[model samples]
Every structure is written in structure tokens, then in C-alpha cells.
Target: MALRRLSTLLALTFALGAVAGAVGARTAPRMWADQLVNVTTDDLRWAKTRVRVNVDHWDPGAQTGLHRHPGPTVIYVLDGEVEEVFPDGKTVRLRAGQGVWNPARTSHNVRNVTSEPARVLAVHLDPG
Candidate 1:
């Protein structure tokens, strides 16, 4: 009877571990970006600066952990939806065709709270 009880406990532990792992995985979905263009600004005002454009993809439930950029950035949603959370507790939900501008050194987090994947076009202007 003791041996049977031990086996049952082991099985229960294994089942709990599997459940925890699955839950952990769901909380941090993978995200990626595709660089579409990178060039140097030639205009007089922003001369010598780097202009980069990328297409960022976020899986359902994915989030860009609190972060900041060295340069000014712009994000335009191409598909799906995303929530931009600021350090001061502000939250903004953006949908397709919407956009937002983030100044340099701004701290924020972008999350895909929806069940569908999201695509965003990002433009960055970095000082050279």
C-alpha cells in the first residue's frame, strides 16, 4: 500500500509540473521584427542620422517588457491590436491604421493582449 501511495504522489507531482510549465509558456509568447530599411538621413535638419524601418510581429499574448529606445520612434499598426503601457499607469490600445510616436528615452511596454497575432511598422530616427 505504501508503494502504491508513493506512485500516486509522483504522478500527481508530474501532472502539476506539466500544468505549471504550460501556463508559464503561455505568458511569454515569442516576438520578432523584420528590418525593412536602414539608411542615413541626408536632409539638412537631421543630417547624418540613421533612419531605420522595421516590421515587428507579436504573437498572441506577447509583450515587450519595459524598455526604452535611444532615438525617437514611431509605431503604426498594420494588423491586429496592441496595448501600450506607460510607466505612469497609462494604457493605450491601438488598432489597425493607428499609430503613436514615442520620444527618445521614453519608458514603455507594448503588449498584444488579444488572441490574434499583431504586425506593426516601426520607424526610428537615431542620432549619428
Candidate 2:
């Protein structure tokens, strides 16, 4: 299906990015992401509840390495601007107060394109 093709494309893009990083062929600032909350439980049918939240900070020109989440992720821009890139070369610019939903297993990258540092709140839902 369409989703499968998109996932495959994203995986290839991530692989290429990883290779570029390993060879020092890329020039992007490193991002700092800190997990602020992680809660897990075991009760119902999807049976468990797991919430993973992270606060990500990026210096000017900094970016996150290509990565994917185990589950869908929601991101809210807290400060500055960000350029989000998808595996298929799609790009989006998000500003403060904006948000995005990242599909699970889809490779993507987030870049801080402004002069100031950028911050974003990321939340993930999981069943464990």
C-alpha cells in the first residue's frame, strides 16, 4: 500500500543519512533531546500504557539525525523555527505554537534553521 512504500523510502533515506554521518559528509549541528517523562503500565487490551515525552533543544543550524519512532509521535514547537524533512524529500517549516504528527517508523529529521536555539516538546504513545 501507499504507507508501506513511504516507510520503505524513509528507511532508505535514514540509511543514507547514517552513512553520511559516519563518513563526516554532513554538516549539521547536533541536537540535544532529553526525556522528561516515561510511564508504563500493564492492564487492558493494548494492555499497557506507555507515554514517552521529551524536550528537544537545538542550537542554531543544529538538527536531529534521521530517526524513526516505534509509535506515532506528536511534536509541538515551543520556541524558534524548525525545518522538518521527510524521507521522500518533503520539507515543512514550523514556527512557535505549531505542531506536527509523525507517523510511526517513518524516518525524518528536524533542523533548527534560525539564529537562536529552538525547543520542541515531543510526545509518544506506546502499548507495552
Which pairs in model 1 have colliding backbones? none
lDDT of candidate 2 over 64-91, digit per residue (tens): 7798888777677766789889989999
* Per-residue alpha-carbon lDDT of candidate 1 for residues 60-96, written as tens digits (9 for 90 to 100): 8778789988887777776789999999999999998
Q: Which predicted model would earn the best lDDT?
A: 1
Query: lDDT at 127 for candidate 1?
Result: 71
Clashes of each: 0, 1
Q: TM per model? A: 0.66, 0.64
Candidate 1 ranges with C-alpha deviation above 4 Å: 1-46
Question: Local distance difference test, per candidate?
Answer: 0.66, 0.62
Which segments of model 2 are wrong by more than 4 Å?
1-47
User: lDDT of candidate 2?
Assistant: 0.62
Model 1 lowest lDDT segment of ten: 35-44
